[model samples]
Target: MGAVRVVLVGGHESADGADLAPVVQQLPEAAVSTPGRSLLSQVRAALAGSDAPVVVLPMTWGRDPVMIAETARTLRWVAGGDAHGRVALSEPFGTTDHLIALLRTAATRTATRWPGSGLVVSAPRASPFDDAELHRVAHLVRVHGAGLEIGVACVGEPADLTLAVDRVRALRPGHVAVVPAGFATACPEADALADVDFVGPLMTTSAVLRVVRERTAGALHDLGHGHDGIAAGLDADHGHGYAHSHGPDGDHTHTHGDHAHAHAPHAPHPDPHATSHASALG
Candidate 1:
């Protein structure tokens, strides 16, 4: 059997590319692209020369339309314009539940700095994936950091940083944690907001990196052409089983392996007669 050739398709950001490179380097045949090149072409070339199954790993924050499109195109090519393939597309790194857990941990670690109240601010221009992640983090804040006030905001959205600050300030929070839900500082929105007192990179935390590496390893196992192995590995690692079924429109539905618990961010006030109206934004 031949070694699988994995092609990691990352963004135009050098830092993300750099972070992803070392993760995939130990593979038998792996390559990364320079910032600002034709990612599709690079992936195609990598595939053309490989006798082993090709795996395309998208090293992005999950918002770049270009990366999404390129990944789709590569999947199509590998699938032979059919529904299956010897080569396959792994779920983008950001979408995994493991990644979500990591984000929650990162948020919690940063929130510790703020003693009284905490806020999780998502970059306004973050990708849909990032937004979804922020929602997950918000839920975590409510569950794990009870008694802390929580608020959510985006840079360009209706609820920008100022809006988030206003909400937090209204509660007279002692500390504020700004979580940049982005993989790189390439986006001006992320860079501008990261200057806040409590700020941290999206995937810089050790937990997040561990999940990324595990997911990458899973991708490689899948590309080796063993469906059962892939599912089993993911299930065992994440403690959540995977299931796929076709809907009416021939669309695929994905079921995650684990269940998440939802909890309120603040505890009930001591005075039973007192009215509490604090809202935890998800």
Candidate 2:
């Protein structure tokens, strides 16, 4: 049996983001395949080429149910062959504890940059689970980010942002800094509002990279070896190309959080931004 190999798979949209390169660079042993092609295509390539068991860590915020489900189907299709059953998909990177820390750092910088400004954390509003994750981030900010007013907004709809802006402005803030809950810098959805500053996305921070490394390590130990049965246990009838339902009895997933982090620059950078979203209003 060959040694286990870890690979980080990101959405195809972040193909050219220079910040993401550090993850692969930092972990010389791990291979990272970014989105441009399909997620299934990247997973297949990694598994087929590696000699050892493969653990794929999807570098996304929140465990995107669609992407997670697709990964299972992709592995079952590619790894079912005579490759010694050595392919596994780890849960998404959003589970990391460092991310909330990073969010605090980002929000703090935003507040400090503008001085006495309230914070509006923004997300794309993809699914109900996504919304829950955004709410979780909001809770984190409210607890750790004392002296700062926090507002959550789903950027997908106009009314949500409008309401969030009104509420945030009501705090008599110096300004409003919009931080991406996942990995976003400039959210046009919020940009339309006046006196709003955009904070850089969280995809490229050292803290985030460390979290990826930790998750890959955990998945390799927890779900990598002899876990094909768990992956294959998904229900066939689940919709949206899902290989399994999200039920606890058969769901093979893991989540991570509760750690510390260091601060980084909050200046917005232009690149292929992160596609993972925690969206819709609440």
Candidate 3:
């Protein structure tokens, strides 16, 4: 038997520290780590005390295949050991059914007032794989948002937030929910448009915390079961959420976020040095 280490990896942040207090306090060995120098520093700190197997859980919604590949390369370059092979990365925070509900909850709460409303999921940028996940989640939003005039839109790269906002505005919906796709980070106080209402970040919700634990716990469980390849396979079929009748404990049947929209197959593995380092389970 060997020591096990857990690192909750997150995106670039406004504050030097992570707002993931709920995540770090849950597990002692579990600490917050990001990609690049911050992650290298965290790795060095963890290793200075003991040599243990590491598991990384990405704290993000919408799996970005590009980011994971970049972090793997960064680990290889810094640690100069079995960083890639030994270190295990869990699925992204976004792919779970819990998050689909959280977004629905937040967006639903804010959209209650308006007769005709739009649902907008915002992120840093758009990629082929990320876009696919965003669209899949959008379908779930539409299902849950039965009464409202729900519309799906992407923010950042390939498409601008304004463009999506405009699409919603064109319909002249009573209001629009600018829901952020990421877990937690710095967000503006108010939306620019008078009719647009910000749904805020999901980091504060218990749902986000539950998903974080699931990723870490799932990794530890698999490590106990023995590798059987890599835990990265979670990203393969999980892009569109799952239909389980229970949580990780299998206690209660969860049928809230289920839908029938099929997503594209997982993107192929790319070169070691890739551009988009954002990854999900891989």
Alpha carbon lDDT of each predicted model? 0.49, 0.58, 0.55
TM-score of 2: 0.61
- With candidate 1 superimposed using the best TM-score fit, by how many Å does residue 57's alpha carbon deviate from the native? 2.2
Residue 65 miss distance in model 3 (angstroms)? 3.1
Instruction: Tell me the deviation in Å of residue 143 in model 1.
Output: 3.7
Error (Å) of candidate 2 at residue 3 is 8.4
> lDDT per residue, candidate 3, 1-282, as tens digits?
136676676653212126666557766777876667877777667766676767766665445544554445445543345443446666656543544666677666765655457666665555555666667666777687545445555544434766777676677645676776665443352255566677676655455556656676666666566651232432233323333333344343212122233323442323321224222222
Task: Kindly indicate the candidate among 2 and 3 with the higher lDDT.
Answer: 2
**Candidate ranking (lDDT, best to worst):** 2, 3, 1
Candidate 2 RMSD to the real structure: 12.3
Q: Which residue segments of model 1 deviate by more than 4 Å?
A: 1-5, 9-39, 49-52, 59-70, 81-86, 94-96, 124-133, 157-159, 185-195, 205-213, 226-282
- For model 1, how does the per-residue alpha-carbon lDDT over 88-195 read when each residue is reduced to its tens digit? 555555532333444456556654655565665455444554455456556665565545566676566543765686677678645565655555333344335433
Model 3: runs farther than 4 Å from truth? 1-5, 11-31, 36-38, 51-53, 69-87, 96-99, 151-153, 157-159, 203-206, 228-282
TM-score of 3: 0.61
